[model samples]
Target: MPLKTVNVGLIQQACGADRNTNLAESINGIRELAEHGAELIVLPELHAHSYFCQLEDPTSFNLAEPIPGPTTDALGAIARELGVVIVASVFERRAAGLYHNTAVVLERDGHIAGTYRKMHIPDHPGYYEKYHFTPGDLGFTPIDTSVGRLGVLASWDQWFPEAARLMALAGADLLLYPTAIGWNPDDEEEERQRQWEAWIIAQRAHAIANGIPVVVCNRVGSEDDPSGQTPGISFWGTSFIVGPQGEWLGTASAEEPATLVAEVDLSRSEEVRQAWPYLRDRRIDAYAGLLKRYLDR
Candidate 1:
């Protein structure tokens, strides 16, 4: 079980073309939040560089680096200096030709707690991640840390309840999503609104189902697509934290760089589960067909 209370900070920032500049900005944001008494800091996915998934080119592969590479080294030092736990997303260069979207947890002492590679890779209109990253083989398991047990998931992973449920079953105390999703410039007002609503509701539903708090940190601002075939995506940066009962704790703006800090009562999860025991009533025996692609005859 977690302590009496855990304070989580979400860093929502705009990604620039320069990776060095972006890393410095994220470091500054983490420091600012730590000064404000944030014990656990979460950063947006791929914070070191601009969203390169908008286009598929061989040059994008250069963005991937090793797990204990320079980025983690710098972040580990920051974590140690501030005595805070940090969850940072990165594009991992596992080998000469293989890469993955990975999240690393750094303990207060600057040692790496664990790592979770993104399982669900999206290949949508603007999210061409499949070309750059291979699906994670690290199964759905929580990373035990100094702060608490963290079930860290990537952007597209938030859309699937199975991923969240598996983490909960594995004893995850809280779910953290390092995300980078945005609105297409050509999307109509109504379409954009619905998409945003679904995005927020889906994660909150995960919190409600698993009886745990959820934290999401998303990138803000728009970056142009190099191909020039279409207008770039305007990242809707409404980073937020939701409670076990699907209640909103704190939320950032949809178009600005901001740091949101909120306190969550980890013990309340037990209370909520006792009152509404969804997990206890699950029919584990009747779910063998879930492995099939479809039930069509």
Candidate 2:
């Protein structure tokens, strides 16, 4: 039986140039968190290498690897050794020319639990993900693990309420986001602060609306752009966990690599839902127009 109260670990760390070094850093963090009583550990998105979506280059595809290849094998071993569940994000090489931003969930026994492919692909100045990854076809489905049912969404997918609601309706116990979002070098400090605040507020809203806890593990440190066309992005770490009522359980530093572990009482969701009842108040019958791309006036 699953425990009523679970401890989750967020590994917010800097990515190194070498894939092996980055993997080793994440592994060390996971081991430490497991030793400190974390039953479920999560790493930031694409933790195997630096954020390479700054520019559109076909050569970047070489970084993508098969899901069950080297990355999963290494993380699986750690999960098995530590007897803890691990959620890891990776750039997946699905086929000869196909790729995806996929999150793999590993059970305590080192077996593959399930995978969540990132549905939303962002295409901005610093994030040119559309050039690399194809939009995930897996849909918004939750993955079952020893800890609980994990509704794993990639970074860009966090911005959509529809995605979160779908996961919640599917009976996900917790919402998890393995993220790699950061500040654009040219943005003003004021704007950067607001952007970060919005990101946190949005996720908190999801927690309150769904009556489930939310976990976000983000990357930290600055990675330079190899092509020199633009200043590199400085990733704001700030990994956090929130309760069912949107109360913060714990948060990491915004500028440092840190491991944050927090105990969450999963049963509290029932109490919060009884008082707030956002899910029960939702008008599921009146959302037919949501299927359209736009309802122009």
What TM-score goes with each of the models?
0.98, 0.98
lDDT of 2 by residue, 90-132 (tens): 8999999999999999999999999999999999888999999
Pairs with steric clashes in candidate 2: none
What stretches of model 1 exceed 4 Å from their correct place?
Answer: 1-3
lDDT of 1 by residue, 159-199 (tens): 99999999999999999999999899899999999999999
Number of colliding residue pairs in each model: 0, 0
RMSD of each candidate? 1.1, 1.3
Best by lDDT: 1
lDDT of each: 0.94, 0.94
User: Predicted candidate 2: what Cα RMSD to the true structure?
Assistant: 1.3
